[model samples]
Target: MTTGAEPDHGFAWPDVLCAPVRSLPEHSRLWVALSGGLDSVLLLHLAAFCHRSRVDVHAIHVNHQLQPNANETEAFCRTQCAALGIPLVVRRVSVNIGQAGGNLGGVEEAAREARYAVFEEILGPGDLLLLAHHADDQVETVLFRLIRGSGVAGLAGMPRARPLAAGQLVRPLLELERAELEHWAREAGIEWVEDPSNADQGYDRNYLRHTIIPGLKARWPGLARRVRHSAGACADSEFLNERLAERQWTECSKGSRALSVPALQALTVVEQKNLVRWWARKRGFRPPVVSDWSQVMHDLLEAAEDREPELREEGFRLRRFQGWIHLVPEQPEVPVSPVTLLPGEPLHWAYWTLTLESVANPESPSRPIRVSTRQGGERVRFRPEGSSKSLKNWFQEQAVPPWERACLPLVFAGSGDAGELIAIGDLWCSEQYSGGAPAAGWRLVVRRECD
Candidate 1:
């Protein structure tokens, strides 16, 4: 029953839409994510009216069948798009909102995942996915992240534009108020479906939107706008942090992949912690809490040089060997025995596998190579001209940690009585079995690090 003439409200929808899309490249295929809601309806109408030819406005509605009238909602969206002379794509998805632990967050996250999956599948490269997120939603997100003690990245709320699989997603209405969108819809005589669950306080976002945000806004009329500003500031700080982290990573590491432990140890404790945290986030690992990070830095950098150091957090373990740190999965001590490999058979291990292939070379020495687990006492003669040295001494000289030594695959040559250690992969390779004359083809292929 709302009317456009109710009040001026000092805002206009046409201006809102034009402002964001003004800078967008002309003739861009814009896909508007329509939820059969007022905001999306207004967005579709405005885009169709303004840039019908230059911008190909397509509507996509995801039917999350959580209500009895889900089919009706899809029909309404299709009709609306048809009326606007735009193409409509309706997708039906079933959301499993169960009553298990983490079910509340899980349901929302799963629905988001499902929606994005569909979007990626349908959207072509260079297309723009437009979302109807407004300033109010950004405010709520900032508050949610604040309650969870999130860092700057979380507090920054959603970005206006971010890269997805095939295309980029843009939240054009993020700078506008929700009330302005409603006013625009009323002026255009647009009809939209009402989702009853939005009013139901069972969901956390609904609870905040209905009960908490209104209360806060009542006391301070521009509370949402102020929080949005704070989010912008946080986003700026986060950007600076990322730039600094990139520079520090380059200066403190030898390769593009991992940091050198000695270089990391040279920095102050604060710098080291920042570098590690930045590295973890860049690698797609969840950022640790402040306390957890303190512990991780202490264990990783400050531990005795000879002592094996390990730090475990959320299925990931960071361990130090010599002057290098590696992130790996926490492995249990599963008993693995050496099994003879046939010509085409692959020897599987916890982390890697060894594949042996035979090549033709008459000059190649016929030596028997036996694969076996380390038994704590074994000598490997690396070269035919060098004296035989204990495996322990070789690992120490190579800077391999004591904990990782037992896990390395040890390859020995010579049968039963003449069996002698020959080569190892990713650890140390014996020189005795290394040299061979090349014929048409002669090579021993061993695949290591297979679980």
Candidate 2:
């Protein structure tokens, strides 16, 4: 109860327990990812006992509300932190189960996603978030990935430290065994809440932790260390893979969002797969998981030139256009109806931002300047008296992708069918609305944001 006033109780912790906590990366504020479990509780006390005076120590508890004793765990964390004179931040998150990877597995993953989301949002510059993952957890993660037919990167398990949001996430006890932490925790008389879900074997990780890992450990005494060694080897292989991908990415890319199809085709299938995954990750999107890369790569690189082949992922897609593979972000929904453009007020249509500014003085548009998607049969006149060209023919002349043609914002100077196309989504603008001096005394400025 209340950890009996203070931790340690005059019991000296060995150097093995104090070393990891004492040595940490440079950080102005230290944060413990407290779950009110044995590992996190011990981590909290270790942080307080070792480096509380050197840095500002705090704790954050994410209550997923998945367990029956969620509130009890949160209270326990608060009590422990309060007793140690450390500030605690508690966040209650709602985990949606049926989104992706449905079922109990989904719940487990969703809860983890929710917890990390909170951690990422809370951490700021000069801050470090410490997690309590240990060697036993590492063993479980490796075995789980291996059983799931993961690649080298997945088999590598979690890193000891990685960047999170604006801060860093460090697992100081990753090299220590769980049993060692439990023994020290008991010796220090530290109190923690028991999560009921940990005992339930319905979850994959819980099943592995309770049923499989114990037997493996009993059969091989150094199972944790051995698995950790294998994970390190996989990590090394993953690093080399990333290096090769980086080199190939540089060769294939032409300093644009798109890559040359011929250059990609020159690479081996494995090389192509690695490069594409690296590119997706570099752009902050998850790589598409295809069961058969040979078919996908053939479609992407060797498909008929006229037929546009595309691979769609969660946040982005790769579409081949005119001998080049373009990485396009999922388009945002534009206005259903035409949006009127006002002077000095910027109109954000999907990825493009438009502003109609007066060259000499602030003034409104002479006619209703509206922004809308293509309605077909629209024509654009390059000159005031020149021959008008169909929008379809103009898009073809410019070699715009078919998928992007429908979503590009079409800005018109007037309303109804008679509206003259003033701008084509930052691609082209009528002479009257462009240049340093405009005939209409106002300039339509359009800018496109990187997708």
Candidate 3:
């Protein structure tokens, strides 16, 4: 066990709570993410000691089941909270860490997902979730992201506060060192659980904390503090990047959801790349390498307007159509068939399907039409008096996006082999076929759309 003499002018529990609470609302309920560790124990104790009136404190402990003593850790947290007269919420989460990515990243990410899920469930609207991450953790996180070739945003490490589902998550001790939390816990006679995994060198974080950080600290005793400052600078730089990205998005975006091709092409190459990266990030897509962005931009901007340009990277497809770029799934292409629909059955398409049923006739002439992909040299005869037109030419006339033209499901009439193509969904229909009057005749009814 490590022990140290208390500092003379150190900011204690009351001082920490009072400083942050002056800005918060009067009836804010703060839930501490207590992991039965020194940092969290100290945080919980501090929250209880101060702000007991205006703030309601609750402790949440998540059992990841990675360690054998996870149960003991939960019991210790419960006991500690009970002694402090604070309510304790224990959540046991089982994670299949091996199936995610089988690395430390996978394990940590799965555990974190489970932990946050429980935290969100316990917290109500406007309640705050307080985490116990400290300055040393922030420094280590920045180093880790740097080694992994992260961008400025990732190298900034964790934010002090962020909005979550139920409320906001705040890291109060982000300015405090880890050693200070241990010192405070010891001074208050608080017992904390020690997980053996923290010392295990197999994990990258443990290796950094136990081996790399100690070596660096030996050379420069304030290395963690310096790295924390560096992280703050990186965060400021990232904020500028974000602001520029937002501005680019405003200039380049078409609708509320997508970017306009002409607007995107008008920008410089660097601005175009930034706009694409920003758009991907905003749409919840993972950031890819510079090479990936290069290919996407080249395909989107340099490819021929009539050609369907698609580039697949990192489980997403950037596709170019008639003056537009759409992000879609990079899943295996499933072949859909143009077949006559039977009652109470579903027809499968690229990502969605259509179901047919019997229904009464409405105001307009309701028609049963077989929708299918446009076949080469296929001509649809509208009515006995109207002239026949090529399906491809008709699609172009309707201004349908070029990429979707070939994949549109074709609908026909009658059974297996004796069906004539009638109507294509949102494209064209044979004027010869009409659901006139619905008197015992086959009426095509769109049932449900499936993905």
Candidate 4:
């Protein structure tokens, strides 16, 4: 860690500037996201001088390794934190530039995602991560979203505080303008590194910051405050949209994981779209982005009964099965050929796990048990001495989705055509293989992942 000029304790800070940092939400520890920039450097000083005595104050610097002087900036952050007697953690991340074509927007987004991932990983309960996003940054963000055709949620701008991982992320300087923060930093004799990329107008944000915002500021003079008000209005609208979606979800849902097709068809197209987006977000997945929602909704809601229509998204898909729409996660590949299920060992198949355990004073099975996916002609015997039914017929009777039937594990007591299907995934198990005392003297336990 290198040393720098310490903050001037004698310089009096304005009450408006200090109030945001002083009146933080209840937290056990405070962390400053130090970027070695003017805004972040000033934020670190404010956090130290205002809350260091009351709570544990620390700093984290994420090195994106994008610019030529990335290492120098990281070193500067270390030096500043060391001078203030605050612990600093430096995380170096490799930003993937494969998606960044000729522009810097992709790189910016990738670095932001990586930085937030680090923050999410380090934050714990009662920890508050302080960001240095000022009013100027908010204006840029809102304008950028507007240019990109973003919805109300995107136009709402960065929140003042929100839950991140197990902790909270707070931007105390969001109400302060960039010029205000820089003026105070220079007044207190603080030092910071100037990133060279900020000067390049090649990046979209840089172009906005240097070319557009300056002119807007000169023309309006109160552009930041006006933008803040508009952003606040958008935020309010987005909140109401979320609440409306929640209520509509409760009305149309068939169960906790699915929606009723008939119930959804009764609602307006806009409501349907909003509910689906809200559901995907609630399940921790990005919402599906389609060129036309009306056509998608029509196919899902009004398609023929024989046709299995579905909307696929990242991580999960929404499929109309029977009378309900099920949100199913993409299952992993299962073994195509027969695999021996040894006693006391758990076998993982797709999203399901199969385990065979021997009962007390149990007798050995008549033959080796194995597990595999359905191989066309298959039979399942619910009883040891009763009649057997075809696997296809049983699945149809149970109303199991076709996509799921292809991956469900078929556990058998023997091999080939003579094999007796003892268990069907986690849905069914033969009496001989289940219960307190089985004819085979063993228990076949099957479990499916919750995700």
lDDT string for model 2 (1-451, tens) is 2242244557887789788888888898899999999999999999999763634999999999988889888888888999999999999999986684667877888899999999999999989999999999999899999999888889999999999999999999999998898888888888888788888888888999999999998999999989989999999998999999888877888776678898999999999999999888888898889999999999988888778788999999999999899889888998889999899899887778999898967456678899999888888888888999999999999988887798899989887887888899989998888999988888999998764
Q: Which candidate is the best by TM-score?
A: 2
Best by lDDT: 2
- Which residue window of length 10 is worst by lDDT in model 4? 1-10
Tens digit of per-residue lDDT, candidate 3, span 1-451: 2233553565465465445534444335878899888888777877776654523777788999989788888888888888888888888999987776888877887888888889877878888888889888987898889998988788889998888777888887788778766766666566777886787788888888888888988899998779877888888987887898898777666443456788887777777776666766766677556655656677777787667777666867677766767766544354555554555577666644655544553433243445566667666666657787887888788766555566666667644455555666634544443365344243444321321
Is candidate 1 or 2 superior in TM-score?
2
Report the C-alpha lDDT of model 4 over 1-451, residue by residue, as the tens digit: 2223465777776777789988899887898999998888888988887763634898999999988899989988888898899999899999889975545888888999999999998898999999999999999999999999888889999999999999999999998898888777777777888889889998889999999999999999999999999999999998999999888888888445579888899988898888898888888888878789999999998999899898989998899988888878888877768999988889988879899989854465667899988888887767667787888998999888888889999888887777778889999998887899877888899998653
| Model 1, residue 205: C-alpha shift (Å) | 1.8
Model 4 CA deviation exceeding 4 Å by range: 1-9, 52-55, 335-349, 352-371, 383-386, 410-423, 429-451
Ranked by lDDT, the better of candidates 1 and 3 is: 1
The lDDT of model 2 is: 0.88
Ordered by TM-score, highest first, the candidates read 2, 4, 3, 1
Clashing pairs in 1: 350-451, 351-449, 351-450, 352-449, 352-450, 353-447, 353-450, 354-447, 355-447, 382-431
RMSD for each of the candidates: 6.4, 3.3, 6.7, 3.7
- Cα shift from native, residue 238, model 3 (Å): 1.7
Candidates ranked by lDDT, best first? 2, 4, 1, 3
lDDT of 1 by residue, 140-219 (tens): 89988898788888999999988777788888789888877776677656677788778777777888888999999999
